[model samples]
Target: MTTTVGRISLAVQLLCRAGVRVLAVAGSANQNWLASLGAEPVVYGDGLEERLRTRAPNGVDASIDAFGDGYVELAIKLGVAPVRINTVVGFLGARRFGTRSDGGMAAATAEVLAELAAMIAAGELIVEISATFPVEQVREAYAKLAERHTRGKIALRMR
Candidate 1:
């Protein structure tokens, strides 16, 4: 969760906070919801490239690869500079493509965390949860995550 999908979610929030336009690549289930968060939605899979181009006709300024599996390459193909691309999951791809292989470390800081918390507290940043599991159900929690269809974070409760 350091700089993976979790980090991508935060990055999106940061962008929205800064008023930067975002093109979020999500599945049909989450597309509208992502749009509600201020990101223009680009559905993942078939026609992804075309959709991205259509959404950002002026060209993408940067990229964040959370799901890996050739996205680093896709971002490169879309004309984003290697230095502007940061990835968490596509380590090998980042190395190969010369993209920054950071786990969202550039955006991490105590002040930022406090700001994010405030955003949530103020409802400025929408926090979606796919599931909530007790600490004892950690296995079940992980199983749900492995399904790869969650639209938001899954919570694990200590109690």
Candidate 2:
């Protein structure tokens, strides 16, 4: 399951393209958008485990938690192996549960970046740009990012 914002859109796209059935856990506002990208969006909050079970009766193959709040445990509880579970914001959870906390670093190879860039250029991938601010507006850009509801990257344009 994934969060509403962050790199969830790209994750969903990549997973869907790989023939994996993506069950995206997002906020209500992003549910429809996630669905349009071939994911079954489940609203995140209380009883998320039950909701996820209802969607994937057989169980999930793996899980990635971008908004870590006990999600590492939740993924383990959902039957995902520790090695297959990765969290971007759950370093403690990763250490405690032996899960991977390797986020961008693990997947940021030049070849991978080139592939993603090619997909974006070929219209096979979509990178949602939540907002763009001039370099002078760095503070304002961070303020917007701090709100935590941006759909994607809040770019700081170098002007």
Candidate 3:
């Protein structure tokens, strides 16, 4: 499971707390931040296959493709079960590979949303606020967020 320090990380953290062995891969250098949230952080670099081969020798339970760069097939090639794959990004190869996203089949219920909100409110999860900027400082806010080593969310106050 890969997640950013934004809203998604909160959910991933909860899943990890619920006994899921989450392998959280951050796109930026904030990998250690994810580790602090009880996830195995995967830093981006070379030898990815070797790393994955060592870490997930038994095959992954599922792979969530947040970047949507046709990782569903890549995950399958890595021996993850196809049925367990899901993607938030548009499927570019669905027609060619005949694989559909699992997300499309499920909808978030109000109860689920409330429970998640409760978790956040209770501080059972951590939300990273790396930086915040007013509307007038959009460029600065974007720069902070674009930083490779950012550890959390960067909020832009529009109001």
Candidate 4:
């Protein structure tokens, strides 16, 4: 399950490309986009676990948490093994549950980056650029990021 503005789109794409059935937990605004990437988009908030259970009755084999509020606990409740769960922004939860906190560092090898680059170059992967601003407008860029509803990355034009 994922949360809004958690870069969930990229995760969904990568997982789907790897043949994993992804059930994206995001807000309603992103449902169509997530579905386009082959993820089963489930609206987040309130009875999230029940929603997830309804979607995947067999149980989730693994989970990735980018939107930290107790997602690790939710994943555990859904029966995902702690070893198979990774949280990018849930260090506290990872510590409490023994789940892995493998974010960019764990998978940021040059080869992996190059592979992703190649995919993007070949049009096999789409990197959504929600907005762009000049470097001088860095504060504005961050302000937009702080809104937590960006559809994709916010790029800063250095040139």
Candidate 5:
């Protein structure tokens, strides 16, 4: 499971390819694309737990909380052990529940980069580039990002 999956499509793709049943939690706007990414979309809102339970009655083995906002608590409610739950934006929750929130720094090794490169080369990973901006248009690019969910990343090209 993962929440607020902005920088997480690759992880979802990898997990799905590995035969893991992934439940991607995000807003309703992200549902369709998420399904295409091979994940069961769980929209964030009231009764989310009920919906998840209905979909996976056996419960989830682990969870990745990318955007916090009570995601850690929700994972605990779903019977996932704290040790198996990794969070990025939920440091307080991690301290409270003992969920792992080591952040992306630890996974920035060369080996991980090699794996990502291989996946991209093999067409197994898709990184969506929403738009590209020259350095002069940096402000405009940021304005676009502030709009939220451009459906991809905004690239700034250098000369």
Candidate 6:
């Protein structure tokens, strides 16, 4: 499952565009939102490894490690080929790959955002809201995230 469910929609959209049937690991949001974006949300109980092993027995086509470090290493272990692997922030132990745009990450991020917006406009993606609290409650917000398994985002209001 993704550590940040709020951002996974872009990944799912990209995967769908590439004709891949994606299975997302939604660690903090309703599974339906991901499904609506063309990914099957597989809950990663215990740990990511356990979920990967159970879901992709023959190894995954590719595993992108957005979480970096230990996560990238685990993705490498599960991928069938080197090209089927990469990470947003380069990890120490994994092979580095070029992103879609050579204009650096900012450009790629923009592209992802465009895709997300398009999906939202088309009513193909749904935003999942877990909770919202005043800025003064930031500590409590973090505590709640640490203590429970939420199905969506925990946002702080500034005004």
Q: Pick the candidate with the highest lDDT.
A: 4
The local distance difference test score of model 1 is 0.76
Over 1-159, each residue of candidate 3 has an lDDT whose tens digit, in order, gives: 332212247656876887777776555555666777887776544655566667766666766665554566566677765566666553764444555555533647888777767877889877778888898999988887555456667888988
| lDDT score of residue 106 within candidate 3 | 66
| Overall local distance difference test of candidate 6 | 0.59
Pitting candidate 5 against candidate 6, the one with the higher TM-score is 5
Q: What TM-scores do the predictions have?
A: 0.88, 0.92, 0.73, 0.92, 0.84, 0.58
Q: Give me the overall lDDT of model 3.
A: 0.63
| Error of model 1, residue 135, in angstroms | 0.9
Instruction: For candidate 2, list the clashing residue pairs, or say none.
Output: none
Candidate 1, after superposition: displacement of residue 16 in Å?
2.4
Off by over 4 Å in 6: 1-7, 26-37, 41-58, 66-70, 80-83, 87-115
On a 0 to 1 TM-score scale, where does candidate 4 land against the true structure? 0.92
CA deviation > 4 Å runs, candidate 4: 1-6
Question: Distance (Å) between predicted and true CA of 47, model 1?
Answer: 1.9
lDDT of 4 by residue, 3-116 (tens): 222346777888888778888888899889988988888888899889888888877888888888899988888888899888888999999999999865778899999998
Report RMSD (Å) for each prediction in the order shown: 3.9, 2.5, 4.0, 2.5, 2.7, 5.6
What Cα-based lDDT does every candidate model obtain? 0.76, 0.82, 0.63, 0.83, 0.80, 0.59
What clash pairs does model 6 have?
1-25, 2-25, 28-151, 28-152, 29-151, 29-152
Tens digits of lDDT, candidate 5, 16-108: 888788888878888898899998888878998898888888787788877777888888998988988888778999999988998666888
Q: Measured by C-alpha RMSD in angstroms, how accurate is candidate 6? A: 5.6
| lDDT, residue 1, model 4 | 38
Residue pairs whose backbone atoms clash in candidate 1: none
Better of 4 and 5 by lDDT: 4
